[model samples]
Target chain A: MLVNRVKELRAKYNLTQGELAKKIGVTRQTIVSLEKGSYTPSLLLAMNIAEVFNEPIEKIFIKREEEE
Target chain B: MRLYITVILRTLLYISLAIMVYDFVRIEQQFELLGRGYIDSFSVNVGNQVGQVFIVITIILVIMNVFQLFVMKRNKRAKVEDYILPEYDASDERSVEITGKAVRFAFVFILLYSFLILGSYMFVPNYFLDFVWYPMFTTASIPIIGLIVYLISFKIIYSR
Candidate 1:
């Protein structure tokens, strides 16, 4: 499974989902799906999100070995 | 505003197409009746309803296009023409991805539905004389059904 710290980092940065989405050049729904783990963002989107959070891509997104 | 306008234009376009098919069938049926000598003259309603509905749709479409054009022209934008054509969800990568999935689902549905529709012709071996409109309507129904399925699938996927 693909895991992300977008929600956590957004909270740390004091940014709403809409603000993060705007910074990442994606829709709010995309961010919602990303946080829910129901969608895997593309590389460009991942890079954009990482940029928004001021973190590396791997730090923001992780590959989990176990299923939920 | 763009999305709403696109949806309205698409609906009007589909309605106009279906109406055109119905009018064609109606005119042909009238000719058949004329050939059979059942009517001394064509009915006054032959093209009136179809024509009026078609004209009204045309007017609405023209008005919308003109309004969009006027607004965009005020901003000195040339992309106003893009608003005239119907398009899939393309606001972002996610929407485009969902649209792709929806289109694929619709394609599969169309293929199966078309096979069933064509197979249904076997049950109506003598359709031309008694049910001429049946074939026309059914044929026109293929794209309409596909579009509906696509829309529903898009809605479901997008919601998820």
Candidate 2:
């Protein structure tokens, strides 16, 4: 499974789900699903999210097995 | 949800179409039974009623579409028209995948339902004479049922 720190980073940046979604060109519900770990985003979306957070993709998204 | 409302409006549009079709078939059946080449007052009244319903639905859908277009033209990010979503939402990667799964589920349901509908004709050998609405309604119900099932599946998956 892919685990992401989207929620943590978004909180750190003080951005609402809708704001983050708009910056990343996605619907707010997609952000909600991503935070809940029920949806895995595509590479393009991951890149956009990384740009919005000003972080590398690896720092935001990681494989669960790798963490283990 | 806006998505659900759109789906409901679309379903109503479909129902209006089915009603119009039902009115047409009923008139045809009347002609067959009476062996006449003319339409009667009751049939015309039924046709007019169905026409009115069809026109109402068409107007609603058209108004929504035009409003969406106007919103897009005025402001690219005016979310007041958010309810005017595209046919399948496809708003993001997650929704695209979910919509795809819903379509697949609907496809499988339609395939099986088609066979069942065909098999039902075996039991009703005289459907033409006895149950005139059976074929008309069932044919129309295929897409209606598929849309309902798709909507249900999409909602369940989206909530998950």
Candidate 3:
């Protein structure tokens, strides 16, 4: 019951997954999985990613419909 | 960086092993001389040198082991928040299990190596055995035990 705005945020920044990962000191695959939504980012990672995109945490990640 | 570190460590190990071999040959020759009722001064110097080499090697290996532990701990931390599994796929489970078994197999090899060296010491020759056993047992056991512990935890968590 978690949704992520990974694609939207990446597009807004005009960054590839590898570029984002390099900026954040993580692997490119991490960005791919974030977009796929199969993997959940930890609180720390979510905060970092949100900060990188210059968006509110709530804007970057929303609870799924059922959870709401 | 890891590669460079490993190379440096391996060089240290080799140098220590070579010194150990040199000492062992000296000891054997000195023992033969003592059997003939002659004391060899040069052999005593070689023996002391051998001990020094052993101490140096022990220190190097201990440092290297600590370095490996730090690297592994960092890797685990990075995995925590840095990435996600693409799917809750069966393959992930299988990969974990297969790697677990591989680790267990490596343990068995260590046990075999120890037994073989012990047997050789008691029967054939004692040279080079000391150089081999400490690193073999310590390095192999850490991952073997860690993987086994991880596998047990996974079984408990996922069984439900």
**What TM-score would every model get versus the actual structure?**
0.78, 0.81, 0.38
Model 1 chain B weakest 10-residue run by lDDT: B76-85
* Tens-digit per-residue lDDT, B1-160, candidate 1: 4545555555665666676777777777788888999877786354566557667767776776677556546543234433333345555678778877988998999999999999999999888767766786687777777777878887788777
- Residue B124, candidate 2: alpha-carbon lDDT: 91
The runs of at least 3 residues in candidate 1 whose Cα sits more than 4 Å from the true structure, single-residue gaps closed, are A66-68, B1-12, B32-44, B47-49, B55-85
Fnat value of model 2: 0.64
Model 3 CA deviation exceeding 4 Å by range: A1-8, A17-19, A22-41, A56-68, B4-8, B11-15, B18-22, B25-29, B36-160
CAPRI rating of model 1? medium
* Top model number, lDDT: 2
Model 3, C-alpha of B142: deviation from truth (Å): 10
TM-score of 1: 0.78
Residues B1-160 of candidate 3 have per-residue lDDT tens digits of 3323443444455555655766566567667777877764543654466467668766866776565545545554433211121111122222333334444554665566556655554552444434434443444444444434434443443332
lDDT of each: 0.75, 0.78, 0.56
**Candidate 2 residues B29-87, lDDT tens each?**
78775676444434445547667877887787787777655655564433433324444
Highest-scoring model, DockQ: 2
Where does model 3 sit among the CAPRI classes?
incorrect
